[model samples]
Target: MLLIDVVRVSEAVTRTSARLGKVGHLAELLARVAPAEAEIAISYLSGELPQRQVGVGWRTLQDLPQPKLVATATLTDVDALLTRIKAVSGPGSQAARKALVAELFSAVTSQEQSFLMRLLSGELRQGALDGVMIEAIAKASGAPSADVRRALTLRGWLPAVGAAALSGGVEALHAFKLEVGRAVAPMLAGSAPNVAAALEKAGVPAALEWKLDGVRVQAHRSGSEVHIFTRTLDDITPQVPELVEALLALPSTDLVLDGEVIALRPDGRPHTFQVTVSRATSKTDVPRLRAETPLSVFFFDALRVDGTDLLDLPYSERQEILTRTAPPELLTPRLTTDDVNKAEAFFTDVIKSGHEGVVVKSLTSPYAAGRRGAGWIKVKPRHTLDLVVLAVEWGHGRREGKLSNLHLGARDPESGDFVMLGKTFKGLTDELLAWQTERFLELADGPTDGWTVTVRPEQVVEVAFDGVQRSPRYPGGMALRFARVLRYRPDKRPEDADTIETVRALML
Candidate 1:
């Protein structure tokens, strides 16, 4: 296929908000692609390449000697260039794609060319698809996104995994764990509307912990080789050699453990999220990191211990096994207080000692892998609610051309009205602002002008608020103390969003 041909698909993918349009675009492009080009296209489109992918992701980005020079290079020329680069440099080099993109951009007219650049750079985000990347892929493939999702969920790769069946066959993708693992973001909770009551009904004690303002880490081990990964599953092994050494020293352990790796002071007080980020930095700075912002981990759950599936075990049982099996430096502490008063004492103690509130846990609940269930309840006097974005306002300074702040709202349980809870300028990123402005517009219905747009409550957002305050902003004189966009909810709906009544109840 011509480079321009690929550009057209990317153009279509960007402009059309409908899932089917994006799907049709990719399908059309794939039908005409040569074997190698198909491989490149499919691989890149998956967003996550193989664990250690076949080529430098930037290969196409950096290969061009004069990528920004803007000179036309034939698709045949681009193909030949990529083939030559691939043959000479193998998978680690990024030059090929750079040159191909440069050539493609040059070949197309100016307008299409700009879209192509954004497409290649991953700045081409359109919030129109129902939800997530796979849904859009499903629309493109003429199948349910759910079906495509299942195939990838079950098989671990997508479009590319499916596309590869044409040549190397599905067996080739057998070991594929599609989404690149090890980049630790965070594992969020999916809770019942009434978390406390839900746990009571489920025949489990609801233990609540102050949801930490820290990063999550997943440690994977193969014999003595221990690798630490982020929630996103990106390996930070090279950065935390001490952690790896600590895991390797563990006795009777061939495991992958789940925990929060946090930075703390010499006096044992936990630091803020900003400090915890140092644990994810490079090994070259380890000496300085240790000296400046020392750290420790709190192991809450174990996934694979000595090759046993620990996910089925009860929470208390997992903690017991973790304590017995883990090394001192490798483990996160488990707070045990069955009595509410004792738990309260511990919670107060930790908070006063500069720690966040304590997490109360259910002894009998099984490890809900990649889930937040009634087994855990975080009891803090501090007010917090996971809200959904109702609207966004224009930004200024460095944040210009993007959303300045979000019109944060919580669900009204009685009428499903997304009553405006507050507006937040906190946690605004240039990229996020751009992403949300375009996204917030998608949810708009009537004119909610004068710096706000009324949205059809569809997206759920997690907002960590300082406290709820009385405000004349909306019916409830309650507004958020501190508010920010945590993450975009794919599994949750506005109906499932936290409500003002729930927020007020927490005031108790």
Candidate 2:
């Protein structure tokens, strides 16, 4: 298929705010895609690439050659070029990759160039989310949405799902099942503000487990071969040896277990998220790296065991299977309770132990993979502080031309100066962005550059964050993690904002 077809569909999809319009545009595009071209077209529409990251980023795309007179770039042509780009590595590969990108860029028209740029840079703001794409594929192929979703979740690849649906319809989707060594999309949980709310949502006879501050990992094992996948289904088997070794030693040979991989302190409390992340992403000398960080997997749910799929089983039955198959040490710390006070105690204990909180799960609910259903609910104690905005950066893509990313600061009580915690562009509505853009200009300390504008610290905004981490880059020794603007605190003064000492206390 021609690249123009994909580009036109993406443009139409982005131009519409209606979900059905987006689905219609994609369904129309899918009908025309040949089996050979289905994978690439679906991948592009779904805002992903066949080759993943091909050593090309925003900086390299600048000052490229002008567009060709004709749009001749085919799906196969672009795919082949991406394969070559991914192959370029080590010494002198940067220039080679850039040259390949330029050659490919020069082959397409300016309109196609814009589409390719957005797709490559992950700025594909077109509402072609995975759920929408699955529905579109189902609509085009005459398969049920449930069948397509199940296949996509188990297969964990949209391109393959697209190809299967196009070729064999619902039969192909039914053929896709829980396979050992293949990653499945994980079941996710909804959020509640507190334990009482979570228990109320979960109802009675629920299992409450400590929500460890760690990476969500799904382990697949068949004898000596074991694979560990992140929540997004990225295979990190080679990076975490301890996790692999533990899986290999498990009594059950063929199974899929859902859990968290956490690095723990000597006191058995989880290490800070930053520490765990650095160890998880370490690529070189990983065995030595594993010893340095020493990760552990705490299994909470069993998806499949001994060739029997457990996803359809009730949570109570799945927990029993997990306890039976996985070692006791590998099991997550958990208790079955419906008592609000007992659940509250568990929540308090989790926070006091430096962990995140607790996940209250319905005992009778099945594992609804890839969907954030009410079966499981998370309760985490969120700490909100009134912090002053130090500056704001111009947003990009969807948020372009707006004062978005906020530089948050905590007041240092002794010095009476603000200490930068971190920057967050999350949790801001378009209305908030417009309001802040005009309001901040009035409080600007200097002239605006359209890139970043510094503002006086008189405005106090309430910020909610997960926690703080030790940072080497900031003036303060610590920085906020996962911070988001909850709301503006116009009634509060800069002096009334939380102190750096208060922020530091969270680190402990």
Candidate 3:
């Protein structure tokens, strides 16, 4: 199949929100593609070629201007390129890489080579391929939208999901068991200030867990080969050897377990995320890294054990199986007491111990992969902000030729005067950049018609800053720390965003 065909399908699927349209597009591609070429094509269609998990990205337009204008490579060329990369690397080692470089992309100019280099490297930029893929499957099998979602969530890939859509219908899809290797996030929390408050509204028996300040990891062992991946599915085992050793030490072989890899202080409290970062790379020696950070594995959920799928089991039964299968060092602890008062006390203890707040889970809830729902509640510190966008700057580097940065501002709610707060280049997407450029230009009064333009305080965006800090730059003698755009609220006038007084209230 042609690369153009893949692009065509991707464009069509992405444009429609209807799951059926997306599924139909993918099914057509599958039917047209030969099995040999299907893997790469399917990956590309899913927008996962450059694994979103890996943060693989393109050289921005300015860095390689000509390359961005050039047409994307053909599918056959991409397939050939992948084959070359594998051929040079060999099965067991990276010996094949240089050979691939010499044989393939070398012919393209250094500038062009940079562009084609990424394509050959197998990193596609489009994230959330699975959702698009479910759409593709739905389109192909003529199944209902829910059936596609159910099967894909249970089985985790479009090919099998396509088959499920045809063979068993919606029930088959609903009954589909979650399989390993499909990256999914644990159900995120619905928050309340305290457990007693959450209990009054939430119906099920809650499982109180120690919400450790650590990275979430999923460990997969297939025979002797062990892989450790992040919650998002990017492999991180190479960076963390001690954790891998702990995983390999598990008595039950061939398992995929979910847990947190936390840095333990001498006093037994989990360290800040900064200390835990030392253990996240591939080359660190396990014993030494563990001694440096001393990672404690807190196993919470399990998907595979001794070839039996445990995702269908309730949290209670799954916990039993997980605790039994775990090595003593790897067992994650859980508290089942229904007493809401105890939960509040526990939350306070954890916070006092220098940790994030607790995660309250439903004991009876089946793991709801990839969605934040009421089944789990994360009770963390709450923060509020009403900051303004001062000036919009043209995005450079990866975000080239786009509006990716904002000069943040603070408004005097009473006086209606705007003062610059901080600057940020994070969180805006390609679509967002386009929308902002158009909208901000309309709001432009006179100046800022050029590349980096200042805007009126008439538009207010609610921003969440990590913390407030003392700064010499702004008029207020303080700045928004780690500021990120939360959302654009048009509901209220500029005066309605938090007053400078509210910001002062949050400061030390």
Candidate 4:
């Protein structure tokens, strides 16, 4: 398949507003993809690359040669070029990589160049996320959508699932199952206002677990070998030896446990998120970092035990399995109750202990990986909303030349456009400032104003505020008061952002 075909389909998907329309366009494109190009095509249409990283940055993309008048490159050609570029390293490798990038970019037409730029920069906003892509794959391959989604959840790789569905249909998708070594997608939780609301959404006879401020870790143990993965499924087995060793010491030799790794103070309060993430992701001087900020593992759910898959089991059964397999010190502090007052007390105790809040989970719901259903509800004290970054203003003083003040927006479900609510510059560390500057520059839409740089609304950020107030300064007719950034939600897309109606309902 030609690269231009994929670009055109992406454009079509972007122009589409109806979900079925988007799925139809993607399905049509998938039907025409060749078997060899299935993976590349599917990944591109889904706003990702099979190569993952090609060692190219915004600076490298700034000085590209003029695009060709016509498109002639095949999908396979570009994939091979990226593979070669990713392999270039050491002495003069930068120049070699740049030359290859230039060669590849110079061969494409204008539209293809734009698509390639977004695809490389991770800012493709065509709404063809995993959900839409799964529906398309099922439609094209005649496989059930549930089967496709299950395969994606277990495999944690959408392109491979797409290829398998296309080549072998239902039989191939059924082959994907919970394995001891592979990392599956972690189950997510929805948000509620308080304990009562959470219990209402999660139903009675629920298990409330302390929601700690820590990095999510999924540990898979097979005999003596243990592998640890983050929420995004990035393997960091070597960086977190303590976690790996802890999982290996468990009684069950073969099990997949979902948990969190946190750094605690002497009084048992959790350290800042930056401290935990820095220690967990550091690649240099690991021994020293570990000694400085030791991490403690806490298991909450068991996905597999003794080579038996427990993903299909209810939360009640999984909790029993986890309790039996992991020692008490390794389990997250939890409480099971049907009384709302008791649940509220548990939430209050968790908060007083310097934890985030409590996650109320249904006892009978099976593990639904990669889906944020009502099976589990998270209740936090403050008013928090998941908003998208619409634009960013240049910082001044010590933070000069960085993207500092963020213009936050809420999704308008009816029109599918983001409505700007307010701007915030608080709660951003120097590291976050540097990271967002580079990231926002890659998503830059056009020439920036003297102070603000407008970008595509694709980055979802969690914002905590005291309350919402009616205001005329924004399009949403309200603004977040004392708004501050909590963290970036890379696991969520813009489509998952809270709607404007939800924001309006929070008015003081």
Query: Candidate 1 lDDT (Cα, whole model)?
Result: 0.56
lDDT per residue (tens digit) for residues 198-281 in model 2:
788888978899898788899999887899988767788888888988988888899999999989988888887757866876
Worst 10 residues of 3 by lDDT: 53-62
Please give the lDDT score at residue 4 for candidate 1.
51
The numbered model that scores best in lDDT is 4
TM-score of candidate 1 relative to the true fold: 0.59
- TM for every model, in the order presented, reads 0.59, 0.75, 0.61, 0.89
Error of 4 at 203 (Å): 1.5
Residues 1-508, candidate 1: write the lDDT tens digits. Answer: 5455555555566666555565566666655566555545554343322222323233354433323433353345544543453454556345554554465445555544454344444333333222334444443344554344434533434545445433443344344332223222223453333334434434434444544556677777777667787654557778666567667777755676777777777777777565676555545767776666655666667666776756567777777788787865555444554454555566666668776555556777775543345566555444457687777676767776665677777765333246787788887666667777787776665564555566655667766776666778676778877676555644344545666766776442
lDDT of prediction 2: 0.85
Question: Positional deviation of 104 in candidate 1, in angstroms?
Answer: 3.6
Error of 4 at 338 (Å): 0.8
CA lDDT, candidate 3, residue 415: 26
lDDT of each: 0.56, 0.85, 0.63, 0.90
Ranking by lDDT: 4, 2, 3, 1
TM-score, cand. 2: 0.75
Off by over 4 Å in 4: 58-70, 90-92, 394-404, 410-419, 426-449, 455-460, 468-481, 487-508
Ranking by TM-score: 4, 2, 3, 1
**In each prediction, how many residue pairs overlap at the backbone (N, C-alpha, C within less than 3 A)?**
36, 0, 16, 0
